[model samples]
Each structure stands twice: as structure tokens, then as C-alpha cells.
Target: MLELILALRNALVQQGLELRAQEASDWQGEIPLPADIARFYRDIGPDNCNLATAGNSFFIPALARLWRMQAGYRWHGISGERLTDWHDDWLAVADQGGDPFIFETSSGKVLHDRHGGGSWQPAPLFDSLEQMIACLATFDAVWNSAGEDIFLDDYSVNPRHRERLIDALIPLLNSRSAAQSLADELGW
Candidate 1:
């Protein structure tokens, strides 16, 4: 896991992508997590994310809400199992290539719907949060870090989203040194 996360960090740095986090104190009064989920956070916390960087959204504790909110709002289709309803037994944790990482509410299952997010064949790519994180970290290292053309070839959802994502990330690519410094400072 350490090796995988490091590879992702290195890839992002090579591409000038910046990761940020807030202070631990910022997480103090935030919405409480489920006992199980909170336990997971306690075990991994900010360290669980590949996107984490010093002062970036992923590394900071206070910004967990923002991350969770983004995850929660992703109401795309989920696994291919029994519970297929939009929001019934799942919570979104992350999204890549239009597919979402989801947590089963009733059963503590973590799943990644990589089949276009719900083409009716919702097979789970992973069964644990750690596995999901690893998948994302690997994807970041292998795909998103390469360049626009590569990202487009693989993760492009549509022309609009593609253009917007490229536009948003290109600036980070343009300013690599600053972002690299932050990652180095954060020991990411």
C-alpha cells in the first residue's frame, strides 16, 4: 500500500497536480461518521487518500465534510446486486471515469461500479475501502498522471466534462514546482 500510494503521489507530482488538506481541528465539529466508517477513518484518516497533499483538500481534517459531501451527492447507479435503487443502501465515496465508489449502508460493503456506473451489470471491483483506495491510487498513477490525451482516451465521459476537467487540471500541470514542493513538505 505504501508503495502504491507513493507511486500515485509521484505521478501526480510529475504532472504538477496539487493535493491539499485542512487542519485536524477543522474536523472536530464536523458531522459524525458511522461507527464503522469512523473506525475506518481512525485507522487511516487523512493518510488513506492518494489525493492528500499539504494544505490540500485531501490532507486536511476540516475538509472531510467537503469530501464526504461530494461523495454523498454522487447519485449514480451502484452495484449489480439486490439493492439497485439510486440512494437506498449505498453512499458514494469517490468517482472516477463516471463510475463511483460506494459503501453499502446496511451491510458494510464497499464496492466500485466500474461498468459505466450502472449498465445493469454492476459488478463490484472491490470489497473493501482499502481496496477501493488502492484502485483509485493505481488509476491516478497509471492514467491521470500521464497527460490530457491519455486521460481523455480512458476516462472521458463527454466532451464537456472532458474539456472542463482538462481545463481545471492543466493549470496544476503548468505550476508543477509549487505543487511538488507542497507534496514534499507534507511527506506525501
Candidate 2:
């Protein structure tokens, strides 16, 4: 978890993004983390929730809502001009087919759900959030090179932080494929 947070901090700064910190007190009982999710915050400090870049943001309830879309939109370019937030769940987390949202299901399995036609086409995307976060380490590389023309379905765990994130990963994983995919995706 710390590994991911550090990466986020560095990534935000690299992108010249602004940082906003949230405290547990700020939640004001409006949004709360269950035990499973609460543990993740302990490392980074529960009081500290939302983090953002200049044009992007990540808040707890975590990148997605329960069995629904997250932000429901995506930036068309690095300049982030064509922003659109959907009023419904089809775009849960992001534009289903137009932009892929690799998100956690209510059952804890990560799924890739997107839409361009009119409905969500959800497919198994990852086994665990930890595994997904690990794979996202390559996001900077992909974004730097490809921008909007890329598919980020592959996932892997960094050997250096494997054990470190496992505790957090185990609680949220519901399928073995997420683990298997890690090995298959990054040759772990």
C-alpha cells in the first residue's frame, strides 16, 4: 500500500498535478471503510483519504462504487479536454468500451467493464487489487508512449513488494486467476 502511495506521489509530481489530502474526520460518517478496506488506510493513515493530480482524483470507496461505475469518464488526451461524467451506471468507473475501468466487484474480483455500444461488457480483468496496482506501475510507461491508444489488461506483482502487499491483497481477492494472471502477465 505504501509502495503504491509513494508511486502516486511521485507520479502526481511528475505530471505536475496538485495534491489534496483528506482526513478521517472529514468523512463525517458520510463514507466509511469496512474492515477490509480500512486496513489499507492504516498504512497511509485512515484519516488521509482522497488524493488527486491536477485533473485526476482517487478517493476511498476506492476508484469505484459498490458494484457500479466510478467517475464515469475519461480524459481524451493528456490535456484532458473532453471530460464527461455519466448520469448512470453503465459507465461505472469509466466509459465502458471507450475507456476501460479495471475495478473491484462486490465479490472482490477485479473485472474490466466498458461500453461504446450501449451496455457494459465486463470481463475478468484481474484477481486482486494489489495485483492490479502492481501492473499499473507500467501505466506511466504506457501513457508516455501510447496516450489514448492502448489496452491495459495485463497485470503482475513486483517481486520486491510481493510479500509487502500480499496481506492487503489476500483480503480482497476472490479468484485464483488474479494470482495466475500475475504470473502469466509479467512472468512472475
Candidate 3:
């Protein structure tokens, strides 16, 4: 996991982005982070780099700004009538615009909830935090290599670049189907 995180940092640096590491003391939440998640925050947090620059609105906030789902609802002043099914233990680790990628503390799984929909039942996106990081790194590398204008007007990757991305991600993710699924999710 540490190796994967370092690889991600290196990939971001290759794209000419700066990263900020977090101090151990910066994490003051009572909720404990999984080891790999903690390592990610310690080694690379508060970075301005958008991991989903390929026509996606994803952003992972710094460790200091990380909060749980319940806190987010309260912070946004979401009324009870607007609330949906949410686990208090799920942390909002990252987001694609308002849709959140949540980390379930008890199950050690990552979930993604598409906001502005029906019941807020998030589905499993990644098996673990490491998988999510790897997917991001793979996508970042392929998208950047394809060039800045890789995405079309509708925010979908150009067909050529989409194939390139799928090809590049297959071996890293160990499944062509998985690669295709990720590309589709990223709006390929």
C-alpha cells in the first residue's frame, strides 16, 4: 500500500503537481483510519492535484478537512426530510462533485454514493483503499499521457484515448472487465 501511494505521488509529480504531507498530529478525529489510509494522508495530503482531471469532478480533501457522513449532513444543514439511509461510521474520504466515496470503517470497504438521487444507499466501489488509489493512479497516468484535450465536449474520453486508458489499466488492475468498468465509471 505504501508502495502504491508513493507511485501515485510520483505520478502526480510527473504531471507537475505539488503535494502536501500531513503531520500525525493533524488527524484529530476520534475515528481511526485504516493503516493504508493513514499512510496516504501522512505521505500525501492536502494536494491541489485533481486525480480525476479527465473530465471528472473528483477531489480528495486534506486529512484536516476530512469528515464523516453525519457531520457532512449537519454542516450542509440538510434537513431530516432530505436525509437518506447513511451509516454514521462511513467517512467521506473523497468526492466526485457532491457524490461521495465513503470509507466504511467496520467493513474496510470503499463505497460511492451518487448524490441527488433516491435513497442514499452507496454501493461498493472498491474492495479496499489500496484498490481505489491504484485505480486513480492508473487513470491519472493514462489520461495525462493521452494529452490535455483527451476529453470530449460531453466530458467523455475520446474513443482513442478511452481505448488507450483501458489497455493501460488492464494489467495493473488484472482484469480487462474491471478496466472497462472503471473507464465507464470515469465517463469514458
Candidate 4:
């Protein structure tokens, strides 16, 4: 997996693209990691990603998202049949020049590069509780708007599978919330 990601990173570098890494506290600014990639997974949570690790390498989903400037909200586990399925889907999109966005059999898709270019430099979009609330509220609208169309449209609609992904993602999101809170209090 790491090798695959590296290969993609090499390809993107050849194209003169870059990733940014970011601090959790800087909600209104881009961190050091790829902002576009971070924004795609931003819904999943912030802790699962590290700019230092992602900045120099290419992750297929990240690459796909970067390539497409996709903000689609698809999430897949690292070790599972679902992961394999998602990877296959990602490759198909990447191969087709369909835009490097991540898609899942469960969730429909999240458009990352809706702006026509991936964000090599992304800014954090939150800083205070108000900011956080606003960000969450906006995302909530996005999340709810999709409703079952993305999550419950097919395999992801299965109780076990849907619950599994959400369950896994919730803790990560919570941890992100806590971490952000701490960072804010410390003036980070």
C-alpha cells in the first residue's frame, strides 16, 4: 500500500503538484499537508491524517481526490473487503482521468476538486467554537443532504456495514474535536 501511494506521489510530483501539512488549531488556514486531500477526509476526522506522513507520499484516495479536486465524502477502512472495493473504484477513476476523487460502493461520491484544481495548499476552516460550530453546521448540511442516497444506497445501507463505518469514524471525529479544543485552549 505504501509503495503504491509513493508511486502516485511520484507521478503527481512530476506534474508539479504538492501537498500541504496543517496544524489542527489553524482552522482558517492551510496546514502543511495537501489541503485538498485534507478537506476530502476532513469529514472523516483530522487525526487519522498527518501532514508529515502524507505530504511526501501519494495515497491512492488522496491522489484521486487531489487529481479530481474532489470533496466527495467517501470513507473506507484500511483492512477490509470494502477497502479493496474502494481502491478498485479509485483506480478506475484515476485511470479514466475522471478526476482524482474518492468514491465508495456505499457512499456515492464526494467531489474534491470542484474548483477544477486540487488544493496543494489548504487552510484550516475553523478556530473558535463559533467557527467550529459553523464548520460543523455546514458539513452537517452536506452530510444530511446526502442522506441515505450516499450511505444507504447499497452495501453501505446494510445495517452492519453502515454502522461499522460510522462507528469507526465517530470516535476519530470525537478525538479530533477534543484535540482541537485542547489546541485552542493552549493557544496553538
Worst 10 residues of 3 by lDDT: 74-83
* Model 4 CA lDDT for position 6: 51
Q: 1-188, model 1: which lDDT tens digit per residue?
A: 65654654555445444344334443432334445455444443433343421122222222355244333233322532334345555655554433455666566766545433434334454455544444334334434434444424555333443333334433443444533432232223
Q: Candidate 1: which stretches are off by over 4 Å?
A: 1-32, 46-63, 66-84, 114-122, 144-188
Give Cα-based local distance difference scores for all models. 0.42, 0.37, 0.68, 0.30
- Compared with the true structure, model 3 gives a TM-score of 0.77
**What ranking emerges by lDDT with the best candidate at the front?**
3, 1, 2, 4
Top candidate when judged by lDDT against the true structure: 3
Give me the overall lDDT of model 3: 0.68
Candidate 4 Cα lDDT to native: 0.30
- Candidate 2's C-alpha runs over 4 A off are 1-102, 142-188
Please provide, for model 3 over 1-188, each residue's C-alpha lDDT reduced to its tens digit, 9 standing for 90 to 100: 66776876676666655567876566656666556567767776635446754656567666766644335442344543424466666777777667778888778788887777755778887877656765666677677677757867876678888888888778667888988987876667
How much is 88 displaced in model 1, in angstroms?
3.7
| TM-scores, all models, native as reference | 0.41, 0.36, 0.77, 0.20
In candidate 2, what residue range of length 10 has the lowest lDDT sum?
A: 46-55
TM-score of candidate 4 to 2 decimals: 0.20
Q: Please give the RMSD to the true structure for each candidate, in Å.
A: 12.7, 11.0, 3.3, 18.6
